[model samples]
Target chain A: MGVVVPLEDDRGRGQNAVAQLQALVAKEMQAVNEFIRERMASDVPMVPELASHLINSGGKRLRPMLTIAASRLCGYNGTDHIKLAATVEFLHTATLLHDDVVDESDMRRGAKTARMLWGNQASVLVGDFLLGRAFKLMVETKSLRALEIIADAASVIAEGEVMQLAAAKDTGTTEDAYLRVIQAKTAALFAAATEIGAVISEKNGSEAAALESYGRNLGIAFQLVDDALDYGGRAASLGKNVGDDFREGKITLPVVLAFRRGNAEERAFWERTLQQGDRQEGDLEHAVDLMNKHAALEDTILRARHYGAIANDALAIFPDSPYRQALTDLVDFCINRNH
Target chain B: MGVVVPLEDDRGRGQNAVAQLQALVAKEMQAVNEFIRERMASDVPMVPELASHLINSGGKRLRPMLTIAASRLCGYNGTDHIKLAATVEFLHTATLLHDDVVDESDMRRGAKTARMLWGNQASVLVGDFLLGRAFKLMVETKSLRALEIIADAASVIAEGEVMQLAAAKDTGTTEDAYLRVIQAKTAALFAAATEIGAVISEKNGSEAAALESYGRNLGIAFQLVDDALDYGGRAASLGKNVGDDFREGKITLPVVLAFRRGNAEERAFWERTLQQGDRQEGDLEHAVDLMNKHAALEDTILRARHYGAIANDALAIFPDSPYRQALTDLVDFCINRNH
Candidate 1:
């Protein structure tokens, strides 16, 4: 089952809002766990080992939660939501495995990555196994629209990765290019997670469109917050070491904004520390200072909040329910969560 | 389109025996190529570039040819064979892209590997792209049986790679384990390629069994020849430099054979050069001499010939036709061809 954090009384009025969402998330998460375990069960040895390593690695399961929340919001009561939820989770896990290999990363979620422990060979092959398993799950849903949307999203995810690789460490990358990559790599799956629920349940055009928009905005907000955390948040808060983006020469939104608005000296700092791939011990601290001075980090936070607001607005079409409220809370949490 | 090689001419066979098989192989190859190009057309930018690079990179297209040949021999005339052929090629290319990353090799088929040219990131992602594309192609066939077969094969392939990694440089690996690894890594796709045709076309149970056996035997033979070529063949003949497997620490059939049969001193040589991971000048030559003296390469070649004969025997169920004869020629080619 999915994990849902319950709100404590000390949180005040927000406690009621959080409690309402927690109960729905808890019930849906139970179903999701059953679905994932049943689907992941295999006679093959490597399949179970590699897949379970990722599936049990304690991802927030945000994508699946989105699917469950969307399905509940549409007044649907069927087990297909579980399948759709697992499908989204599997897709996310597959990407993580591949991403770790691409980045040659040693750590993920403060633990050694699959590539680190099992080697890139196993990580890549298992990533592939998970992908095939995802498709097998989607095919079982038997909704042509679900298949088309998910498959198209997968293609976009791969294309986005290629685009990112091409654009890595390049100062010329535009905000538009960054937006396209984020939408493809992150939001495409999110859109599918919510949209597939409406699609499988045969929701009307307007309802499906609204759910998709909510998923897209929430995904954008989540990724922007993640980018910000890389530069500004603590390891305790982010569950990852800061400055990983700069080390990997990843030109994220905060850095892009800083480079755009910073003065000449600040531009030299940005070029040497981030773009030129030379960083001193205090480079991360200096970069953070520059980002604050240029208001780049603030600008990025505002953009994330904007998307979060847009996510909340998209749910206005759905009738008032605890599940719908939880969905809205999730958008807020994307910006507010430390890890 | 698939490459067409004259079979009987190399064997100095009678003209009557060669004409039918060559014509059938040519016709089937044309269909397979058309299917591949048609399926690979995509709106994704890097996808077309990456896909075409692998598809057009002068692979012998042997696996798809085997599929088409097997289907025709089983009296299948439907167009689904083309899709099956393309599916097999896509699966094969996906493995190659992944294998290059795993092996850390920079060249394939006498040209720079996709990983080398585009970097491991592109290679890994594009490999995923081809894999997803393969599934999409299979789903269009609307055959659940086809889907199940391909899915099972993909899982086995992943397991096989893991098994190899686990067993690499471990002298404890037996001939049986070696066979299992090759079966999972190589024969599963070959078996699927042939069996899917019979299942999709609704062939008789006995015919299906025969085709499956033919594919399995031919696949084993193909791999055996490849292993032998890695040890003994010249770069010009194999399209790759010699001693590649040894460099990767892969203990193939010949090495296993030599390790088992060699005396104490020869076994010590194996351990020092391969297992100990220290190779001085002429180490490869010395290993080759040891393998030759132990008759390991000859034994491997004999085993390959044995499987090739079995592949030929599996064709007894089919009526004598040009297609059947071409399938038979492929058995000979697998064992005898240098490349």
Candidate 2:
């Protein structure tokens, strides 16, 4: 969430675009928030307690907002958008819970993970409970097309996660393979979120295709920036540890690039630290220096900027509404945000 | 799935009901098995490997068979029953994967658990993949009512698990609470599986209600018997440890009954072993002795028999077809199963 918000526009205008995006969909987001709270409730106290801890913890609510903004941009005027928004948020949260358990990470979004606070058992089960709630919420929308899109996205996301796990410490992974991983893991749901928004609004023309493209590109850009930040950004600002991927020996785009460009000795270092899990005190610092020397982090951001540009262009067909403008600026915010 | 299938019927003149059930649905089960294998495929190697480890590792496919048998009972001639059957099995397998992870169980059904073999992370993500596939299968049926039934059941099951987790190690759990947990965790899916068969067949008359009743009662009986066997059944036969719940301090119907009926000193013993986790060397034997003294295991079986009777009577409205007879005997098989 704490994305870069320029005080002045690129043209030196008065106000920022993120503020405008929230301004246009602010009331709808309130409704979405209320629906989320209502659905998080359960007769079991731990269900609600664990749900609230991670949910109410400071997520940017970016995906739900995408759903909300996309629906409004498509001229949707029904209460179902609130449910869909909540559905997107719930699905995202469910994945986060499972991801923490999978990664064995203690913190997420600057708060203690449900896995850390409650234990792995509660984290796994509660994640499942939330997913079930998400499905029920999706069914309530009565949009089978929407259901198909999100469900397929979910399946693809899981497949991507499986791929990432297999490629976790292999320096030999190609850039194309890493791209496929992020595309499926990060971008599929974003595309589904926006596509479902248009589907629910009954807009199946280029409008739906356009929103899908926008979401897909934006998601890719967001993940690339996240990869860079994990290497180069501050923990307090990013709300996650710097070099978290490095610490986990996780293979991301930056790692892929650094490994490919390194010499024989550097390659040995990479293998020892990542593949063999033999890290010394200064390995993180040395790894960052190698990335910097190879311009891996910068190139990753450059790749993200390319996607962010594509995301902005995808929305050009829509008239200059505040919603469209904010979405375009949101893409820029995702690319330029240090966090 | 190594259920206590009898060698002969009550009349001692025929094959076991489980065998009969298999004979009736053998062709359809072959197709369901094919579909499950096809869906478990992924570009990622570990997805299928982990899926096969738990899924094909000797589960009896009870829930899926329930769907097939129930649909056949309703005289449905469509191919969707196959999909529904696979859907139930996928959901069941998904839950099993997650359950093994949550319980930190090293084994399941006499084989190594996916978590134990592939690690908890793979188990968790692959479980999510299977769940996504299950939903996709449900949606493909184009029966929104069927989707709604199964989705709701899944939510209830998760809620049940959360309830159980909270109630774990608390011998003070009431019988009503225990019933709720078992109903949610186990019965909900069983009811949903059978009810969806009726729903997809468009048999919404007394037939659907009867199937629902049958499934619910049968599920309760099955779970109660499982609880009894966990303490009393042999490891080789049961395919699980004898004192799993006891070691975990889990509160089941037997534990609830024994704790409520024990004298002051015996209650203290129960508290020390179950609540305080101060298990001694002979704790398992001592626990069984106390349960035997209070007739806890017998009463639990008696309760199971009551539900089993209800299950059989629920199918009486249907004509005395071979499917109906097989289902009735299957209920008996569940209640009387030693493992």
Winner by DockQ: 2
Per-residue accuracy of model 1 over B179-247 as CA lDDT, tens digit each: 888988898888888888787778849877888889888898889878888886312122237778887
lDDT of 1 by residue, A144-241 (tens): 57766776787778878878887877766788889888998899899989998788778959889999999898889889988877765322122237
DockQ of 1: 0.43
Candidate 2 lDDT, tens digit per residue, A1-339? 443323324523212556777788889999889999998999889998999898889777889999999998999999898999899898888888899988889778777788888998998888888888888898998888888887788778888988998888898899999999999999999998998889999999999999999999999999998888887632222233676787888988888998999999999999999998898898988888888789887788789889988988889999988788889888877776665
lDDT of 2 by residue, B181-212 (tens): 99999999999999988998999889999999
The weakest ten consecutive residues by lDDT in model 1 chain A span A1-10
Residue A249 of model 2 has an lDDT of: 86
- The true-versus-predicted C-alpha distance at residue A332 of model 2, in Å, is 0.4
Task: Tell how far residue B105 is off in model 2, in angstroms.
Answer: 0.7
* Model 2 score (lDDT): 0.86
Native-to-model Cα distance after best TM-score fit, residue A199 in candidate 2, in Å? 1.1
In the order shown, the candidates' DockQ scores are 0.43, 0.75
